[model samples]
Target chain A: MTATAPQALATLPLADDALILSHRLGEWAGHAPVLEEEMALANIALDLLGQARALYAGLAEVLGGEDEIAFLREERAFRNCQLVEQPNGDFAHTMVRQLFFSAYQQPLYARLSPVLPLAAKAASETAYHRDHAEQWTLRLGDGTEESHARTQRAADALWRYTGELFQPVEGLDVAWQELAEEWHADIRDVFGRAGLTVPEGPSEGAWSAGAGRQGLHTEPFGRLLAEMQHLHRSHPGATW
Target chain B: MVTGSAPAGRHPREASLTQLAGSVPDPELPVITLAELGVLRRVAEPEPGHVRVELTPTYTGCPAIEAMAADIERVLREEGGAERVEVRTVLSPPWSSDDISEEGRRKLAEHGVAPPRAGARRAGPVLVGLSPTRHTHPAQAPAPEPVRCPNCGSAATELLSRFSSTACKALRRCTDCREPFDHFKEV
Candidate 1:
C-alpha cells in the first residue's frame, strides 16, 4: 500500500482536521488573553496534535512518511473541513468554532471507537475539548452586551462552514444523518442555555458553505498552509 | 489484555526487563515511576538482545511520551545491556487515571495533589467527562465523588478550572483549607 491507496486517501481528511486545527490553536501561544486560557488552548492543541500524529503514524505504512504527507501536500490535497481552516477572528469566534467542531468530534469518535482504535482513544480527549468549548461559549454568549454580540456573530459566521462536518466522506461508514441531528441538538441545547440564537442558515441543505473534505477550501487555507509548511520545507531534515 | 502468556510461570528474563523499564521516573511527575503511573504497559525480550516495550499516555497529546520513550531506551540499552531497544506506544484501551497504582495515588496525595478516584471511569467508549456545573444530562449519570482536598482531607473542594499546570491535572481550590491544588482528574 502506498499514498495512492484508497485507504490512505481516506485517512487524509481525519489527519488534516486535527493538524490544521492544531496549527490554528497554536497561533494563540503567547497571544491568549490570560495565562489560564493560554494553558487551556495549548493543552487542547497538544491533544489534537497527538491525535494527528497517531493517525499519521498509522498511515506511515500506506503513505511514504508522516512528514512527507503533512509537509509536502499542496493546498488542494488537504481534506479537513473548511470550518477548521478558518482563521481565528476573535476569542469569541475561536470559542464558537471550538464548540462546533468538538461537538461533532465527540459523537463521531464515540461511534467510530468500535472500529478504529485511534478513534476510541481520541473519544476521551474530545470530551474534554467539548467541555472547554461549551464553558467558554456559555460565558461569552451570556456575558456583557459586547460579549453577547461577539459570540452570536461568531456563531452565525461559522454556521455555514459546519455543514461540511456531517457530509459523508467516501471511506468512513458513519451514520451521517444521525450524526448531523445529534450535532444540531447539541448546538441548540448549548445555545439555548447561553442565550445565543441558532443561526437561520440551512445547515445540511444545498447552498450551505463547505467542501474542504473534497480538497476544496476557502481562501485563508492557502496562507495557513504557507505558514505551517514553511519551516518544514526550509529545513527539510532539521531536527530539534 | 494478555498478549503472550504461556501456561507456565513467567519468564525470569522478561520479569527483570519489565522491572528495569518500569523503574524510569515519569518525566513530568518525578514522584512517581512509570510503573507506579501504570503507563509502562509491558516489556518483553522478543528475541535475543532485542527489547520491546509498550508505553501508554495518560493524555493522547501528553508531550512527556517522547521523553518517556527516550528514557526507557536509555535505561534498557545502558543499564539492561540490551543491544537494541524499541519502545512502542499503544493507545487501545487508552490509558485512564484508574491505571495509576495505589502507591502512585498515595504519593500524589502526600505531595498535595489529589489522586484520581478509583473506578470513576468505566470501561468502553464514553466521553472523558465534564464538570458537573454544565453537563447536558445531569440526571442520567451518577454524581461524581467530590474531589477531596489533599492538604486537609476535606471534601470541600471546588473546581477553579478544568485545566491547570498540566493537561492531566485540573485546578481546584479547597474551601476548607483555602489552598489551591491540582487534582489528577480521571480520564
Candidate 2:
C-alpha cells in the first residue's frame, strides 16, 4: 500500500516464516485441549498472519510492484527457517518450539527493533507471545512427571535446531551477531527461570544451511507450498 | 448546516476539528476511514472550546488498538478538533465484520487482503467450521462456504494458516492461481 518498488529476495524468510507458523498454529486452533487454549493459539495464529501480510506486502513493494511474488512464488522460493517447519508433534512439542523460538525472538526482535520498522511496530505483540510461551513452559515443565518428561523430551528434540537460529543469513549476520551479543545474557536468564537451558552451540559451527533465507528451501517446502497454494493454483479467478 | 457563522461568541473550531478527526482511518485496515468503522462514536463539546471523541476497538485483543487510540488522539489534536481527545474502549457490544463498510471491503481486496465473510447464517455452531482440528465436536453444517481470494477471486482458496502476521486474519491461498492472500479470519 505504501508503494515502494519490490526488491530482490532480500526480505524473504522473516515474513514467510511467520506466515508458515501462523498456518501451523492454526492447525491447533479448535483442537487445543481447552477452549481457552484454542482461543489462545487462534489468537497467536492471527498475530502471525498479520505480521506475514505486512512483510509480504513490503516484500512485494521492494520487488518492483510484483504482487504475484507474495502469492504466486514457488516452494523453493520461500525462505522460512526449518524450526518452524517441523510438525507440532504434541502439546509439549508445540510449547517447546514456542519456547525455543520465543526465547530467540524476544531478543532478536528487541535488537532488530532499532533497525527494522515493522519489528518496532510489532514489539508489544512479540513480547506478549514470548510471555505466553514462557508461561506455558513453566506450567508444563514444573508440573507432573508426565508433563515434565514430555516437556524435557520436547526441549531436547528442539534444542538441536536452536543452533540454526544463530546461523546468520547473508544480510542478517550483521544484525544477528549484534543481537546475539546484546541479548545473550537476557536469553539465558529467561531460559534459566523456566527450567530450560540455553542450548549448547553447534560443534560444526557452520552457517551455510544452503540458502533457506534466500528463497532456496528444503524438499518438504514444496509439499507445504503445494497444499497452501492448491486452491489458488486450481481455480484461478473463481470467486464466491 | 449553519453557514460558517459560529453562535455570536464561539470560534468555528468544532467544525474544523470534526473534519480533521475524520481523516484518521482504522489502524488495521487503512482503506475505509475510522468514521465508517463506527470506531469514532462521538465528537462532542463537553467544555468550552474542547471536543471529545469516544473510540472503541473492532476486537477486544486487536493488536493495533493501542496505536489506534494514540493515532486518534494525535490526529485530533493536530487538526484542532479537540484540545484533549479521550478514547474510551467499549466492549459490551463487540464489533462485527458486518460493521466494515462496503467500500472498506473493496479497499481491503484491492490491497490483496480478503474481506471478512458473512459468518452467521449458514452454520451449525458458530465456532465449529472456523477450526477443523476439532474432532471431538460432531459434524456440523459445512462451513458457510469457502472464502474467495481477493487477488485472483478464487473460491478454491484453502485455509493455509489460521494465524497471519497480525491476530485477526488467516493466510489463505487461492488453489487456482497459487496466490496467497490474507483472509480476515472470522472470529
Candidate 3:
C-alpha cells in the first residue's frame, strides 16, 4: 500500500532527529578522547544514519526521493528536535546529552515496538545506546570531583531542551505523559546512583522550550546543516 | 525458510526465482549467502516473469542493505532471467544473531569472527559499573558465557569493547593467543 500523508508527516521528525544527531556524532570520529570512544561514537552514528535512511525511504513513497529529502531541504524546512541539533560541547556534555536522549528514545521505542515494526527493531538498538550512555553517566558522575562537576554542568545545561521530547506529536500512538514520567524516573534513578541530583526546575509545561516538530530549530542547526549538505549540494547528481 | 521446491502442479519458474534470490551473497559478509544469514525471508512471484524478494537487516543501520537489495535485483535479472524484480525489507520479528544458520556460524568462525553462542538472546538492562541496581532475581540473570576465541579455539577471551567496526560485531581479545578478534554479537 502507498504511504499516507500523516504517516509521512509522523516519520519526518524522527527521521530528522536521527539524521542530525548522526551528523553530530560523526563530528567526533577522529577527535574523540580515546580510540575506543572514537569507534563507539562512529558505530552509534552509523546506526542513527541507518535509521534515518529507512525512515526517509519510507517517507519517499509519500514525499519524494530520499537524497532530496535529506540533503536538499532548507534549514527552516527541517523537523529535528533542538536537543539533537545542540552542539556537542565536551566529552562530558556529549555523554550527558546522549544519556538524556537515549533514555527517552529507549522507552519511547519500547512503547511503539508492538505497533511499528521499525520501532521494534530500533528499540533493540536503542537499548544498547541507553546502556552505553548509562554506563558512561556512572563513570563520569562518580569519578574524580572534576569529572563529576563537569558532567553535572552539562546535564543542567541540556535539561531544558529535553522538554520537547515528550511533547505530543501527531500520528504517534505514544502516551506522552507516561513516556515523560518513565524517562524522568529512569534519569533520576541513574543520577541518584551516581551521587548527582536531577537539576531542579520544570521539565515540561507551557514555558518549556521547543518547536522543532513544526520545522523550527535552534541557531546552531543552520551551521550544522550547511556543513552536512555542502558536499552533496556542490556535487549535485554526482555518484561515486 | 522457503525452500526451492515446486509443488505438484506449480510452475518451475517460481522455484527458480526463490533459488536465484536465495543465492545472492550478503554484500558485507560475502562468505555467507543471504539464505544462510537468515536475511532472505521469502521469495515469490505475483505473476510469471515478475519476482519479489523479502529481506531483513541484521542490524537496523547496516549500510550494506541497499547494496544488497540492488545486488539481488541485478542477479535476478541477469542470471535468473527475470523481467521484473522488487526487493522489500521487513523489520518485524527483528533479526538476531541466533537467526544465523549453523552453516553461517561455521563460515563466520572460519572468517575469524566468533558466532554467538546458541540460545543466548540479549536481555534485561545492562547495569553500569559499580551500580547498586543489580538484577533482583539471581535465577533470571544468566552467568556470563565464555566466548570461544575464533583464532585459537580457546574459551579464554575478554570483551574489549561492545562496539566494533560494525554494529553486529563486538571486539574481543583472546587471552590465550593475544589476538583481537570480532565476535558476531547477539542482538
Full-model lDDT, candidate 1: 0.83
Q: Name the runs in model 1 displaced over 4 angstroms.
A: A1-6, A204-206, B1-8, B123-143
Q: Report the lDDT tens digits of candidate 1 across residue range A141-219.
A: 8888999999999999999998889888787777888999999999999999999999998765577878888898999
Report backbone clashes per prediction: 0, 48, 0
Per-residue CA lDDT of candidate 3, range A61-127, in tens?
A: 7778988988998988888888999999999899998999889877777777766677778877888
Number of the top TM-score candidate:
1
**Candidate 2 — what's its lDDT?**
0.61
Write model 2 residue lDDT over A1-240, tens digit each, in one string.
122322345446667777787777878966788654676687877766666765665566555333355457776667777777667889989977876666666565545555454554354456556656766677677677888788878766666556566667545433566555554565566557657656564411363233455555656567667766777668775456
Q: For candidate 1, write residues B119-164 as lDDT tens digits.
A: 7567332223334232223222344666789999998777766678
Local error of candidate 1 at A88, Å?
0.9
Q: Which pairs of residues collide in candidate 1? A: none
Give candidate 3 regions above 4 Å deviation: A1-8, A205-208, B2-12, B120-144
Model 2, range B100-154, lDDT digits (tens) per residue?
6666678888889887766531221223222332222212235566678787787
Q: Which 10-residue window of candidate 1 chain B scores lowest in summed lDDT?
A: B132-141
lDDT of each: 0.83, 0.61, 0.80
Better of 1 and 2 by TM-score: 1
